[model samples]
Target chain A: MFDLEAVSAQWLGFTTEKMTAKYPVEHEPIRRHCQMVGNTNPLYLEPGYVEKTPCPPTAIPIFALPGRLPPDPKPRTTVLDIGLPVMGQGFTNMSREQEYLKPVYVGDHLAMQMRIVKLYQKPTRLDPDSLWIVTEDLITNQDDELVCLVRNTLLNFRTDEEWSATGVTKP
Target chain B: MSRQRYWEMVEVGEGMPEYQLEVTPTLIADQVSGSQDYNLMHHDRAFAQSQGAPDMYLNTGFIEAMLCRLVTDWMGDSGTLKKLGIQMRRFNTFGDKLTIKGKVTHKEMNAGEHLVYCDVWVESDREGVTVPGKATISLPSNQLNH
Candidate 1:
């Protein structure tokens, strides 16, 4: 049986203990990646134009911190592998709410500190045979400035028989 | 820096042009490396299939940045991207073509500041499924007098 209470309690104190990683921003690579991703705006790809703006582009900050979660060892496993009999999963990127405390240069070394901000367990509305577990991760840069906040929601389904055995409503 | 008067003559329903992106393995790899995301599912084809994913790996939060750029690009430099929200509905894999589009949905005047609200989405060309959900943004008032 999954312990909702225990899981919630564990998520409460999740923190980074000197958890850090660095990425070198090769101008060509960053620009090419931006171009390949269809972001060919002058502000991001054209260095001459970006020099005239307050921020190169929000994508620069995003590229500063790119993945779902940081690479670190923790007491609990990542939410991706949490649920059993996994049916399907998805990631809902809530937004990038931040303050550019300092300019992020091309060669700047960006570090991240991540923690589990929230977690919830709810029944799936789409499929009566499943339940959805949502987890939100808060990430910040080395300067203690907010970089990007990511919320990833994963869905898992119990077999139809499992639902019937529990006498749960199909609806 | 000369601030472009983006808000001086803006109108509702007016938006920037659309952009198309092709998802590739190298793109996904660079994103994973930059973000320190070593998840095998995003970079390993065999592992992804073993895990039931249709392809080797898919794009991550970078998609949000792409959509946000689409909005900011239309709004111009003086425009501040206040907020952007996206729900990942479907998976994007290598060889998949995606359409990044945005439209001005609402206009408002608050405390003498002109703001234009826009909605954005990223739809996959193959499945016609929107991989990212509705995004809302706030742009400066082009009507403001310097």
Candidate 2:
């Protein structure tokens, strides 16, 4: 078994030197995001509906959250998977916590930096060798203002071999 | 068009009407294609079954979009979503009845805005509370200028 705790200790507080989106937020991708959800609120799509609001273009739906948005061209994975590669184990998304701090606009250039905030291990009678990886992604807009904070917890299970190798039988 | 809910009209502990969301194959396909999250388990049934999933599961982006719709559908155009969070405990697979539900947990007046906090979840026939999360929204007051 690899030294999971030692490896994780090295990763705590690890953050990327901010990563900027390859492209700015676009209408087509935003439209696709809306259509997928069947959201027809018009604030995001219909210019006329938005015209009735205080700021016509300020009400784009949350689908346009460029702060946490995937790169324009779309890939199998997301830019937010900051710490998954290090664990080398199958994991399931357990929870996500977000705080929207500022308004994100379509033309804003969004960038993200991530940190491994914590590593929690819980040994249960049923799944004693499981652990949770908590990562926080601090997202910012062009002005360097923090627009969103997306924190996620993933339950990573150790394989039988891994459990045997770790020598800690009970989780 | 959906109902336009204002800050004055909503109250703490008020329950937002629940809606049924269907997880279909074509819908999942559109979601994966749109988000570019082509996880094999989300698109390929054979591959999914090999991994012990009964069928193709919905991707995280798709679920997030659906959750956004659930809130925005209630808040209307003037409302701004400050944050939306979700945690998945199980697969939102095809043929499941996704019942989206939410209730206001906390509300406060702050900095010329009405901030509402809610506890939300997407439950399915297969997995109860497959995705449970929280959201914070800033809405324009119906009575006062925000």
Candidate 3:
């Protein structure tokens, strides 16, 4: 029994208060991130090579997530905060859109705020009662300047239903 | 930062050099750790299986990073990623080899900013097109730098 109305009512217009990162952006994490992604772009690696340390704008989406720092983490909201009453084992990434408005540099403190944009109950061939959720995140710097805007869509559905619908044996 | 791909040099409908990457568990773990996603789907195979996923797949952040690399590597350090949009159609499971391809679709100057639009997609060996995306990059002009 999926309660579409109740779930939608709970998350609609739900936005979190701005939460600031514990520390300013550093070069070490950025370097490690670049290395892990196999990104050799000198712009993100070498500090003195460029006029300023340009944090990979793409990386900001990850950095914008909450709980990056534990042990008394700041109260930040995320798309995961929405708890649906559906019987789903997990959710999957559906899509994402990011708009970089301003450049983020090293030593800048980033603050993130997320909001639930909308939710749709669309059944898919793989699963019945597929719920699609859209979230919008605003990333700002210490100066309160908008750095980036990230909109993400996620799909949540019952694994058993998907298996049954596709007639595939569950692994 | 020194290298530059000038806006004038980019032509509409020009294909970029394809980038190939082999998907590995180590890479997936690295992405999870780097992004701090801590999502079970990205790490725990059992959890992913329980979710009806064939295997633990890459996270959204990782895919976005790959798309960013594809564009940055092509447009050089001077290029700026103004916007990026991606639609995930299939899961990029482990052991899949990915080929990232992109082409310049449009170019124009907007309010003194030289913007180049591109169509980008990642083709997975297991799944044809796992992620299709578009990017808006601002490239430096030779005149501006010189």
| Best prediction by lDDT | 3
How many Å off is the CA of B98 in candidate 2? 1.2
Question: How do the predictions measure up, each by TM-score?
Answer: 0.67, 0.80, 0.89
Over 4 Å off, model 3? A70-77, A82-87, A161-171
Displacement of residue B83 (Cα, Å) in model 3 is 0.5
DockQ ranking from best candidate downward = 3, 2, 1
Worst 10 residues of 3 chain A by lDDT: A69-78
Write down the lDDT that model 2 would get.
0.67
Q: Name the top DockQ candidate.
A: 3
Worst 10 residues of 2 chain A by lDDT: A53-62
lDDT of 1 by residue, B1-146 (tens): 22353554566677667887777766776666543445565666665554445775454546665676677667766666655666666667777787888877777766655666666777787777555444444455534444
DockQ versus reference, model 3: 0.52
Off by over 4 Å in 1: A17-29, A48-111, A122-148, A154-171, B1-5, B24-38, B110-113, B136-138, B143-145
> Considering only N, C-alpha and C atoms within 3 Å, which residue pairs clash in candidate 3?
none
The residue ranges of model 2 lying beyond 4 angstroms of the native Cα positions read: A47-87, A123-127, A158-171, B1-3, B49-52
Per-residue lDDT of candidate 3, residues A20-68 (tens digit): 8777777776776776678887878887843385788888865665576
The best-first sequence of candidates by lDDT reads: 3, 2, 1
Please count the clashing residue pairs in each candidate, in the order shown: 4, 4, 0
